[model samples]
Target: SSPLDPRYTFENFVEGASNRLALAAARQVADGSASGVKFNPLYIHSSVGQGKTHLLQALTHRLKAEHPEMRVLYLTAEHFMYRFVQSLQTQSALAFKEALRTIDLLVIDDMQFLHGKQIQQEFCHTVNTLIDGARQVIVAADRPPVELETMDERVRSRLSGGLLIEIGAPDAATRRSIIERRIALTAQHMPGFSVPDDVIDFIVRNVTTSGRDLEGAVTRLAGHNQLTGLTLSLTMAETTLKDLIRVTDTRRVKIEDIQRVVSKHYNVSKQDLLSSRRTRSIVWPRQIAMYLAKSLTLRSLPEIGRRFGGRDHTTVLHAVRKVEEMIGSDEALTQEIEVLKRMLEA
Candidate 1:
C-alpha cells in the first residue's frame, strides 16, 4: 500500500492567506525546481491539523508521478525511529543507514516526537549526507526547530538552516472554502448530501479551529442527514455540533495550559505531574492532565505522551480511560475535572 493518502493531493487543498506561501513552497519542492539551497530541507511547522502532512504527502505524490525514478521515502518520525531500532536489533544498522542516505527525496513528519541521543545523531548525519549530495529533504513538526526542546540542538540547527514555513490557523474565508470542499466531496459519495449556505456560514463562523474540525462538522451533519432522512438546516447543525460551537469562541487551548492548570488545581508541581512518581497524588493529577489535554486539544496520543515526560501513547490512552471511568463513578473527581477544564478554557 502507498504511504501517502490519496485524498490529500494538492488539488483538494484549500488555499488561504494562512497557508498560501507554504503551499507554493511545497509545489516548488515537488517540481524539483525550488531556488538553490534555500528549500532543500524545507521545514514546515504548525499546530495540529493545519495541513502540514497534506502538503508533505502532496509533494511526495507529485514527485512520484512526475519523476517516477526518483527515490522518495515519506515516513513519520516515529516510524523512522522504529525502523532504526529494528535495524539495530537485527544487526543491519549499516544497511539501514545506506538505504536512507541513498534516497533522492526524504520526508519526515511529526519531528516533535523524535527523541533519544543516538537516533537523533544518526538522523542529523543522514540529513547532512542527503543535503550535501544535493538531495531534497522535507520535514514537518508541531512547532519550529527552536521550540523542539527535546530534540538535539544539532538536529534543530540542521533543520533551521533550511527554509522554515509555518501554516497558520485558517481565517474565515478559508474555513468556508474547506467546509464547501468537504461537503462537495461528501456529496460525490452521497448524492443527496448538501449543506445550505446558511448552515455553511454557521459552521464557518463557529467551527473556527482548524480544517479538520470543519470537515468533522460537515461529516456529522451528513451522517445525521443520511440516517434520519432530514434536510440539513441551521437548527440541525447547531444541535448536532453544539459542543464544537460552544468551544469555538474560546481561546485555543494548548497542552501546556492543560498541564499547568491541572497541576495547580491538584496542588502538585508541573514537574511532579511529568515525573515518574507513581504516587497517588502525582498519578491522579497526571492522568487528569492527560485526559484534559486529549479532550481539549487536537494533539494525538503520542504527541501528548511526548509532552508528558516521554510516556508511551498507550500510557496516555490508559490515563484518559482511567480518568473517564472515575468521572462516571466519582462526583468529586467529575467536578474537579470540570473545574480544571473551565480553567484551561478560560
Candidate 2:
C-alpha cells in the first residue's frame, strides 16, 4: 500500500501573520536547534481546519527526512485511546507499552478526544516514558490543556508543562494565498481548466474565516464546474457556496439556539450566561455566544444582549468585536467557538 501523504507540510502551508510564530516554532523544533528545547512534547492547539493537523504532519515529515532512523508515529488521540483499550481487553497491555516505548518520536493529533481517567493515565505513562528517554513527542488538539474540561488534571498538567503553541485562523492575505495555491493545484490536476483571479478574490472575501472552509469552497467550485462543463466565475462560486457565504441565514440558526448550545457545551448554567460574571471562563463563552447570535441570526444587538443576560446593546457590540479580534488571533478560543458553531449547526 502507498504511504499516507502529509497534509500541512511547508510546501502546501500558507505562511501568514496569524501563524508565522507557530510555523517558525515548528521549523525550529524540526531543526533541533530551538533554545531551551526541554519542551520536547510540543503541543499545538487550534480549531478544526485551521491547519493544526497539517502542521503536525509537516513537522513529522520534515523530522523523518532529516532523521530517518527516528521512529515517528502520527495518529489521532482517538486511535491512541482505541489501541490502549484494545491492549487491555486483549490482555496485551505489555505489548502496547513496549510498542510505544520503542518509538523515538510520537505525534498524536486531536488530543481533546483523549478523555476518561484510564486512557489519560495510560497517556501520562507513555508521555513520561518518552520524556525520560529523551524522545520527541508532539500533540495537536482543539484547545489548550487548561481548557480541556474532559481531561484529567494530571494529564492536563503534563500537557501544559510542554511548549504550548496555538495556531490561529488565517488572515485575509493568507486566505487569498491559500485559495491561489489550491487553484494552482487544481489546475495541475485538471490540465485544461483554471480558476480566475476574480473568483479567488471573491472566495477570500466571503469566506472570512477558517482555511479549511476556504479550501472546501475552492474544491467544491472546481468540482461543480468540471462536472457540469461550466466556467468557474465569481457568481457561480458564490452560488455554489451560498450556504457557506450566508452567515446571517436566520433560518439556519437563532439567538436562542446559540445561547443554548454554548451553555450546554461549556456546562455553564443558563443563569451564569445571563449573569454579569466577568470571569474569564464566563466572559469568553458569553462573548462568543453573543457574536454567533448577532452574526448568524438576524437579531439586533439589543436583542442578542437581552438573550445573554440583559447586558446593554453596546456590550453585545463589544463582545462581537472582541470575538472577531480573538477569532483572528486566539487559537484555543477559536477552537471552542468552532465547536459551539458545529453543535449549533448540527
The prediction achieving the highest TM-score against the true structure is: 1
User: Candidate 2: where is the Cα deviation over 4 Å?
Assistant: 1-3, 35-38, 247-346
Candidate 1 segments exceeding 4 Å error: 248-346
Q: List pairs with backbone clashes in candidate 1.
A: none
Model 2 local distance difference test score: 0.80
lDDT of 1: 0.88
Tens-place lDDT per residue, model 2, 211-327, is 788888888988998899988887788789987776422434656677778888878877888898878888877887889887776567876766677789999999899999988
Clashes of 1: 0
**Local distance difference test values of all predictions, in order:** 0.88, 0.80
For all predictions, the C-alpha RMSD in Å is 6.2, 10.5
TM-score of 1: 0.74
